[model samples]
Target: MVKYLIRRILVSIPTLIAISIVIFTILALAPGDPMGEFALNSGITAEVRENIRRSLGLDQPTHIRYIKWVTAFISGDMGYSFTSRLEVSSLIFQRLPVTLWIVGFAYLLGALLAVPLGVISALKRNSAFDMVLTTLVFFGFSLPTFFTSLLLIIIFSVQLKWLPFIYNDTLQLTDFNSFIELIKQSIMPIFVLGLWQTAVLMRFVRSEILENIHKDYVRTAYAKGLPNYIVIIRHVLRNALIPVVTLLALDIPSIFTGALVTEKVFRIPGIGALLIDSINSRDTPVVMSITFIYGILIVIFNLIADILYGLLDPRVSSTK
Candidate 1:
């Protein structure tokens, strides 16, 4: 296990390097100037903007800039944002907690909602209850996140006035009331995210469970006088869940990806929202930093999924 893990980590280093290089090169070649905003200023002359751009090292050859960026990255100094002139890491860290809280909890709620509902729907396949769940799941999956977010805002925020239409980033959690206020603002975004996750995952869960339930081992467990529920839960579900675990591992990292639109809709001040803003402003340093970080995260999660496969199925580790 240790050897396998070390091998995976060693392999990931070069993989991450390749990802960073590709991402940096693409962004470097993209047709957008970090000084675009300055160009819009009627007061700043073209020559003044050129000097500003040169001062920021944007005038350097792409290879040189890439080399400097990579070196700074290795030294734990993610270069400053082209717009804010603030350290990229600081900006990410400031928004990281918010993204983790909202995105993480949303995924958790989704899994909690999906697993049981999927099992039940499969158990009662073709029933009215299953039909209703399927219908709802269809809408959940088919609807774009922004549409659902707006619908929620209208129903809860505008009509009922039960929740805030926009998230309050400035509010500090110094008291219980503040915490309650936070939950109130968070409910809609979480629901929007959770609903979509549940829709996608529930189908996979139901399909996996259905495939496993009638297998030979489950029948043998039943023949051995095991309770039906015990046979399904212990023998069937155990095998059914292995692939689901991989799906879950991959999906966990993707919660951030899905949260990009949700965060913007809710004005949550999350890392996703920051990344979008940075991209719109063509803050190449910040864009490069965030996108590279996302690449790293995907690699890490893939590694984690591989490790979990070995843990859940000992045969995998034995083979290694």
Candidate 2:
């Protein structure tokens, strides 16, 4: 296992480098000046603009700029955002917690609800409860996240006045009251994101469980006088979880991607919103850094999934 892990890490280094190069090249070729915001300022002369460009090293060749950016990034400096004039790394770190809180909690809540609902649906098969759940799952799955977010805001925030329309980033989670406030603000966004994930996962869980339940091993377990619960939970669920684990592991990257839409709708100040703002402002450094970080996360999570596969099913060998 250790050897396999080492090999994967070593392989990922070059893979990450290639990914960074492609991302950098694409961003560099994109049509926008990082200093375009200053172009309309009549107070800033052409010479002053040139000087600013020189100071930022933007006057250098594209390859040279790329090399400098890569070197700075390797040394723990993520460069500065042109618009905000803040260190890119610092900006990301500040907003990362909010994104994590929403995405992480939503995914966990979705999984908790999805697994049980899926199990019950499969156990009951074509019952009325199963039909109702299926209808709701399909409805949630088919709707766009932004639409759901807006609908939720309208219903809960505008009409019902039960929850806040927008998330309050200022709400600190130190004490109980602050924590409760955080939950209140988070409820809408979390529900929107969690509902979609639950719908998707519940279908998978139901299908996998149903398939496993019909397998010979489950039948043999039942034939050996094992209780139905024991047969399903021990013999069936353990095996059924293998594919679900893979799905969940890969979905980690989607936490950021999905948050992009959700954050925009809810007005949450998170990495997703920052990415959108940076892109619109043509802040290349911030965009590149965020994109690279996302790529790294995806790669890391894929490795984790492979490791988990070995753990979940001993028949699956990591060494291979």
Candidate 3:
């Protein structure tokens, strides 16, 4: 397992480089000049403008600029935001806590709820509860999160007036009242993200459990006078969870990405909202930084999933 992990880590280096190259190429080609204002200013001399462009590395070739970017990133300097005039890393750090609090918690809540719900639904099969849950699961993921956000806002914020529609970023959690306010404001957005992810996870878990439950091993365990619960827990869950782990690995990094639409609707200051603003302002530094972070997360989580395959099922050879 350790050898396999080391090998995977070695493989990830080139994979990340390839991903960075693609991201850098796309961002470099994207329409937007950071120094467009200087070019448009009649009073600015052409020499001064060229000098500024040179300073910003805009005068360099795309490949040269990419090399510089990677070097700076490795040196722990994420460059400055074109609009904010602040370091890109600093800006992202400022917003990281907010995204983690909301989106991270939502993902955790969804994953936890999905396991039991899926198990019960599969166990019950075609019972009324199973049928209802299946129907709900179908609609849960079928409806977009943004739509759910709107519906939730209308019901809870407008009609019922039970919760705040807009998130309060400035409200420091210095007191119990402030904490309660945060919870009230966070409910809708969290629910929207959580519901969607829960539906997706539950459906997959239910299918996996149902398939594994009828296998020869499960029948043999039952024939040996093992309890139904023991057979399902010991025999069924281990194999069933392998694929679920893969699914979870794919979904977990999304907490860092944040829910773009839900955050926007709730007026939350998060990485997703920052990404949106950067794109609109044509702030390539921030945009590239966020996308690169996402690429890194994908590679990391995929590696984790592979490592877990060996742990979850001994049949899955790690060295292979």
> What TM-score do all the candidates reach, one by one?
0.92, 0.93, 0.96
Q: How close is candidate 1 to the true structure, as a TM-score?
A: 0.92
lDDT of 1 at 122: 92
Off by over 4 Å in 3: 37-47
Question: lDDT for each of the candidates?
Answer: 0.88, 0.88, 0.91
Q: Order the candidates by lDDT, highest first.
A: 3, 2, 1
Residue by residue across 1-320, what tens digits does model 2's lDDT show? 77767777788899999998999999989998988889999999999999989999988898998899899998999998898889998998898888888988899899999999999999999999999999999999999999999998899899999999877887766889898888899999998989999999999999999999888988889889999898888878888888998788878886764388999999999889989989999998899999998898888987888778777786665446
Compared with the true structure, what per-residue lDDT tens digits does model 1 show for residues 1-320?
88888888999999998998899899988997778788789999999988888887888998898889889898999978878889999998889888988999989999999988999999999999999999999999999999999999999999999999898999999999999999999999999999999998898888989998888888899889999889878877777778888778777775554378999999999888998999899888888888887787788888998888787777876777
Model 2 residue pairs with clashes: none
Instruction: List the candidate 2 regions with Cα displacement exceeding 4 Å.
Output: 172-178, 254-258
- lDDT score, candidate 2, position 69: 88
Q: Rank the candidates by TM-score, best first.
A: 3, 2, 1
Q: Evaluate residue 279 in candidate 1 and report its C-alpha lDDT on the 0 to 100 scale.
A: 87
The most accurate candidate by TM-score is 3
Query: What's the CA error at residue 181 for candidate 3, in Å?
Result: 0.5
